[model samples]
Target: MESLAPALGLGWDRQLGPSLPLSKVTVSAPEKDKWRRIEPTINTIWPIVEKADARAREFVARRRAATRAAA
Candidate 1:
C-alpha cells in the first residue's frame, strides 16, 4: 500500500484521478478479509498505514493552512 502512495497522491491532486477511462475497482469481501489478516503478519503494511495517516494529516494541515492563508 505504501507503494500506492504516489498514485494516491496523484488521484488526490487530480493529476491521475478517476474518470470514465480510469475507474477504480474494489476488492471482494473475502479478499478484503484475507488482506486484513495478512496486514499484521506481513509487517510491510505498517508503513503503508503510517503513510496513509500522514497523508491524511497533511491534507488536514493543508486545509487549515488555506484557512489561515485566507484569514
Candidate 2:
C-alpha cells in the first residue's frame, strides 16, 4: 500500500506544500463486507473520476487565463 502512494500522488511529508495524510484503517467484519460490495462500484467508476478530474483542471486553467486577461 505504501508503494502505491506515489502512484496516487501522495506524499510522505508536507515539505513540498500542504499534504493530506492517507492511512490504513482496521475495519470490522460488517464494514469489510460492505466495502466488498462497494469496492467494485468504485472500480467501475474510476474512469469517470479521472475524466472529471481532468475537466476540473481544464476549467481551473481556463478560469485563471480569463482572470489574467480581465486584469
Q: CA RMSD for every model? A: 8.1, 10.6
Q: lDDT score, residue 10, model 1? A: 34
lDDT of 1 by residue, 1-71 (tens): 22244323432333543433523564443334576566566686567588888988788677656656776
Off-target runs (Cα >4 Å) in candidate 2 are 1-46
The candidate 1 region of ten consecutive residues with least summed lDDT is: 5-14
Question: Cα lDDT for residue 61, model 2?
Answer: 72
- Each prediction's Cα lDDT score? 0.56, 0.61
Listed in order, each prediction's TM-score against the native is: 0.34, 0.36
Give model 2 RMSD, 1 decimal: 10.6
Best by TM-score: 2
